[model samples]
Target: MPPLSRPPRETRALFRNAGAALPTRHAALLERCVERRLRGPAQVLSGHHNTNHVLRLGLLPAVLVGAVPFARLKYRVPRETVEVVPRIWPREWDVLRVVCRFLPEVPRCLAVLGDNHSLHVYRGGTVLSDRGPHGRIGEGLMRQFAAFFARTAGIPAGELPPLPEDWPADGDSDGFLRRLVRFTEERVHRPHRPRFGTLFDAVGIPEDAMARFLRGLHPLTPRPFALLHTDVHRANVVVRRNRIAVIDWELALFGDPLHDLATHLVRMGYDKEEQARMTALWAEAMTRAGRAELTAALHDDLGAYLAFEYAQSVYPDVLRAALALPPHATADDFHAAAHRIGHALSRAREPLRLVDVPPEPHLIDALRHWHDAQNNPATPR
Candidate 1:
């Protein structure tokens, strides 16, 4: 075991031989996060970095370790896509403390580490992904599950009391939408442009169109806002023998409730039939829970929210696509990247009015150019 206060360089060398040690920096971060806890002894059950460094820390009755500041862009043909790399370690302790108070479905938080990491005690069940790709537990379970959150509906103003800091600080619907667009622009899109500028140009994601979409989406009927686990996908949902638990609070936000459902539908791998059924179930649950106002315009407005999801997703999707191609990428690698990026652009076509997506060959050339530039010794990045 590494010492708790070990310098990161020494820590990296200590774990250099370990299989779980990804890169020196990632290994040091992971070891440091674990060192703060499990003082006696610990095991790294699994390691992954989606939005954070996730390590399942034990074999049975496991606790998950999530450490922030890990790399993202770890992708493909049209099979799957990476959405927004959510804000890492976003006041999750405070958010989870609030969510567990109102929603019984959330997993209990075991510990909040000093380093902005969290330990989520395993809820002792399987995530829905284990069942199948679509991960259906039936509409009865869905409606029952949806109704469990009915209380989120009808909470009077100031009843739940805002977080010490609301994410956007402006609770209006328009501000919330604008904030999401800004998150994509500032955090995901702009940061990597210098390194991957050509890829951005080739994908031709319409920045002005995204801005226009946000403006157009603002005036629609506003839904009552509630706390949303904005990243509610199949993996985040744990289905136990008795109860269900939603994990991962880092991306939770206070926003239109319908956005939550839209996120779930997109991320949960639901088929079209299941999507409709689940939507009905969710709406009934919200309406019965006294959130009729929120669901009132969902029929007319759900498309916009779903569109926002895809639109915001484009930033991360493109970044990940470019990052997937290695410096010495083969023809096959470029071909796959073209397919993947093409799929993402096509998904956003209708919503963002991406009228002119470049052909596959141009996309391939752009990605190769960007990858080579990054790896070239003479290139000044």
Candidate 2:
């Protein structure tokens, strides 16, 4: 399939939808923007996997800013890629439909444009990454985070989009994590193996790295599943009126709550003290929500999920760092990539059972060779 940035050759719409959910004026503006190529007030945010334009509009009385601090809308333009990593991609509009039915604090689906280019009401506030507490988000925000987790988990499965046929049975935590490991191996590593095998060997990432990680993994206690914003990093959070609005539902999932918590704990860039505090907060909130069973093995199982996260992330981190290099990469570029990949490898070492970490010179040489081969397929090293 062609990437989201490119218009398809054939004209079968992917995410076609009537703009019934949006306000009439908002719908008309979006229609003009997409159909008539009329650009509007917006801020284009460039990201590795997507380029999003956040529309800035006047906060008229009955506009999109009644409750929100300001009026804004954003359109998604997925970054071009060679499909290196697997994407869970929970149709953003569909996911928003479910969330909006429950949480008004969440964003809503405004419309789907050409090729289903996504347009949604943007939350107005500072993203947590931009202007917020770095390590610990204080007791108040911590409580809000906990409540958000519980509330999201409380969303019934029946309201969610249909799962894939092969999705793990509900609450099959072990199966879910194992499936994730297998996906990284089968979808990511294996397909690119021929191209990156030598590169992997040089970096000490054995072919069976994921397999080994899986084999050593112990089965997890079953936990009730819930909707998980799997990519709840600092950037995905928006703070307004002392409340946090989480955006970007593309990587959302329905799975064990602990996995969701673990992913958040890791990606929020929280220190050890904050992580523990957040874990406690989550436990309390789940109990208060009367879903104590979900965290029955919290202390024991949370680490496993954390390990899986670290283990799975290594592949994409290394690959993206490598792919980000310029065609005529300088020593500085190579040095930066080595640092990125090396950090990934270091994080994955225990989880992936990696030994003999590649020294700097060796890693530099490996990257040079890999880049050369990628640029000049006919030229033998």
Candidate 3:
């Protein structure tokens, strides 16, 4: 069967609702700007947040149009003035602009719309996960990511602008752990009145023991601050030509770098063996770059951070499954995802315990010894 084409009216409406609200002259100007920047014709490819539309133009790919809402009621805003105006909403454009200036790998900026609106020529690379079946490419990409951040660390804190005032700093290890404890108490340890039925109950995690397990954990020490890609999950990374290209700077911040490393590990579904291999590679890269101290801290903090990361995913999954109601496919899908995450966590728990030793002198070597001992009866600790 032939595929259906998107209706022009529907496409126009989508663009309008997404806040382009452009005048004929302004629309012409935008087209000219796009033409000057891109080699071919531009077409709206997708829409999100009801405002941004992804427009594809030949080799340039889709440029994102970010729009800001105006409060004025009667008069239609003129578009001519809009093209030159600064973006009014979340100021990620400001940071993106700064990053692009500093890093050649980032997408180049085409133009700025009114406050809260702007245009960026898209990067024509596949998001890391969209790369072919995950294997060495993923591993190589991760090592590249570690190297990228290590380079960013050399930028003086005073030189880089502080993270936008709106972005949360909770991705920091200390804040993340503290938030996990609270989420555990409120969602898992309390009465079973969760937004979704508790995963703890489904997984047979006794409510009474949940609090004790969480309370027994200590906060990871905050490491030296550097520019952080706070959400370094699989989806946020792009792999092109076997090189890692990081994206989604929306949650970027200045904080402990280990949080980013931990987030990457958590998202990649790295089992114990894979985690150990990746950590060893990362350590080697950091050591070669003269950042061994930071790498050591990250290796030490991985287990504590993983536990907190797992807890964060649990309640949200449970809540979503409960709210959907009925034995429908969607509900089943949610339940299945929750179940998978629960099981993954259970499997991860043993390795996490082996790796969770506090970071003192010789702590990591000791944990490695302990893990080895558990694996082999003849291996003396």
Query: Over 4 Å off in model 3, which ranges?
Result: 1-53, 57-90, 108-118, 132-139, 163-194, 197-214, 219-222, 319-341, 344-381
Score residue 216 of candidate 3 by CA lDDT. 51
Task: Give Cα-based local distance difference scores for all models.
Answer: 0.60, 0.75, 0.49
Best by lDDT: 2
The ten-residue window of minimal lDDT in model 3 covers 69-78
353-378: candidate 2 lDDT, tens digit per residue: 88657888888888999999999998
Which of the predicted structures, 1 or 3, would earn the higher lDDT when compared with the native?
1
TM-score of each: 0.71, 0.84, 0.58
- Tally clashing residue pairs in candidate 2: 0
Choose 1 or 2, whichever is better by lDDT. 2
RMSD of 3: 15.3
Residues 283-355 of candidate 1 have per-residue lDDT tens digits of: 8887777677778677777777788887777767677777777768899998998887887787777777777
lDDT of 3 by residue, 174-213 (tens): 7645544564566454544441233343343344444545
